[model samples]
Target: MMISETLNCGAIVTTSQKGKGDLIPRAKGAAKLLRIPYVERKRLSLANLQANHKNKDILIFSQKGPQLFTGEGKAHEFHLSMAQLRLIAYDRGETDHLVEALGPEAISSFLDCTAGLGSDSLVVAYAKRSCKKMVALEGNPLLAYITNYGLRHFVHENDTVTAALRRIQVCAVRFETFLQRAKDDSFDVVYFDPMFEVPVTESPQFLSLRGHLVESGFTEAILREAKRVAKERVIVKERPFSSIFQTMEPDELLGGKYSRVAYGVYKVKG
Candidate 1:
């Protein structure tokens, strides 16, 4: 999807009130990269800037990190709490459903088609130590930019987490486009975590993400492309009750019996 289509409310890049000397250049660089305008904060509040810009969304660089403020008053930033918790569990020799779905073989390359906030990708990188090449694709420009920056800079107590973050390469392109251009058997595994058809209403994070998402669905064509690109397997993450299971009819299903989510796997090669 194009930037204009995804961010129809339009967007401008700026620095936070606390951000002055150093953040200014970074904000300007982000604006240039996104092909959007850079507005001088001048100590102006986000609300005041929103009012002046006719309520367009704002991407702000600060001493803390990058944050995206939607025109509708929603704010989003990258956080590693989810991935951290999972990693902690893994350290205790617990099972991770996604990793379990990848099978017992070592993975050399992995492709994440829908890398929302990259929580899953981070876990995979850290757990699948054999995976040397990991690429994550996000269609939304705003999401792509913030996530890419966060993965590279987000500080973590565990050096393993920090190292995992650095291992992923985030690209600002739709998965369909990337998959189409990719050569056959280019990756050891191809994974998709499309936004759930039924929203997890209780989760505040999902609610916030719903507004900014580009909103793509799982389809047979995409599954075919992913299968072609993956040497070993193509996996789809979805709610257990999702209709995609009926339509796609994956070769195997991997997840706990009571788990809310499931991984549908299609083996491509032995």
Candidate 2:
């Protein structure tokens, strides 16, 4: 779903109470880029600000980073989530199923069709340092803006993770649009982690992102596009029971024995 369709009243960018001096200008710049109003936070609470602004969604910039607060009051921010643990496991010589499915060879370029919080892309970037080009696509402008800001600014104690975060190029474009424009065999790997038909209730980040997500279903056409663009393979991360496995019929499946999620790999024909 496009943000405009979900957020009928549109959105505004402002800073938290701690947002002052440089923060204000940065907030204004974000507002300008998003083509939304830049409202002064002043002494008003988020609730008060929403009420005054007719309940438009708020993008709050703080000294820490940018956070998106839905009119419904759910807050979305960038966090490493499972990626941190995955990176730690990688450091300990543990294998990640997604990375393993990406193949053992060094990846030259990778495309993540659904960036979400960018945890997967971050992991790929850290695990596959040989990858020279990494692009992550987020359709919603608000989510894209906050995520792009967070990827660039969020500091991690692990310098490698921080560097990996900096390496990903986040673009606010629909996956279908990006795929359509991309030339055949342009990237080594193209990946999709589409929103599950059934939500994962245990994941707070996923729940928070539920409201902002674009409901672009994974289709055969999209699969074809991904395959055409990928020189090596196109991978779709889905629930084991997802119909994509049957309909799209990946060349191979990879997952842990007890894992709920699985990766379906479609090798591009030469």
Candidate 3:
């Protein structure tokens, strides 16, 4: 069944896929468009949803356990969920280089040209250490809505998450529109994670239904636009051996257990 039809706007429900329960949900009217597991059973309510966002209560849906926004604030709440499969990368300590490459001191502002689930943006927010603003651009409405909801609920609790979110701005429009809205080289960094073709793994749940529920492909146009809009650098994440994208090569590569962090520290010539 469609996840939205079973949900109510502003109500909190525990989601179930395949008859399993325990994903947190609020009905922000995107249930049909987004495929989030928002249901309207008796156990769901508005106060619970509010509490989930406020960090005053913990919601454990299914087996995902307790995932608080843990971000710095409103601006930083813009993000993607790090599901079990992706958590493998985080567990092996790959996220640290992303934190190091951007750095705590050198960065002050970020524009996520490809803010999928806002995960990359959230991480950037957490690591910015000194950043005051993060403007995220997402092409998917469903993912955008999910990310926006997350920001509103949980980002205000942690000092780092709140601080980063304080500077967060979201454009629910396409990346090209976002690119047109910005001046050339106006930001300290413009990040990209254009979807790459990867072999289907056992972990389909790790992929958001807002994204392709099935394995899928991303476009070259998105990469081209990312280079054009970024002021300081363009970072692309992909599997090490994929070799399909035609974008600029990284000034350096940050090693990961199963992937390579390809990044270009951009510098425009006068």
The models' CA-based lDDT, in order, is 0.84, 0.84, 0.49
Residue 17's lDDT in candidate 2: 81
Residue 144's lDDT in candidate 1: 80
Candidate 2, residue 128: how far the Cα is off, in Å: 0.7
Candidate 3 per-residue lDDT over residues 1-270, each given as its tens digit = 111212222222233232242233333234433433344434534344445454321112334322222122221123345532343454476566556556344677788766655666777776565767678876544445555556554544446555554455665556666666667666777776656556346434243232321122444565556556665666656655556434544565554556444443433322
Give candidate 2 misplaced runs (Cα > 4 Å): 1-9, 72-74
TM-score: model 2 vs. ground truth: 0.92
* Residue lDDT tens for model 2, 120-205: 99999999998969898988878887778878888899888888998898888889888998999999999999988666677777
- Provide the global lDDT of candidate 2 against the true structure: 0.84
Off by over 4 Å in 1: 1-9, 71-74
For each candidate, give its TM-score against the true structure. Answer: 0.93, 0.92, 0.58
The Cα RMSD in angstroms, rounded to one decimal, for candidate 3 relative to the true structure is 10.4
- In model 2, what lDDT does residue 87 have? 90
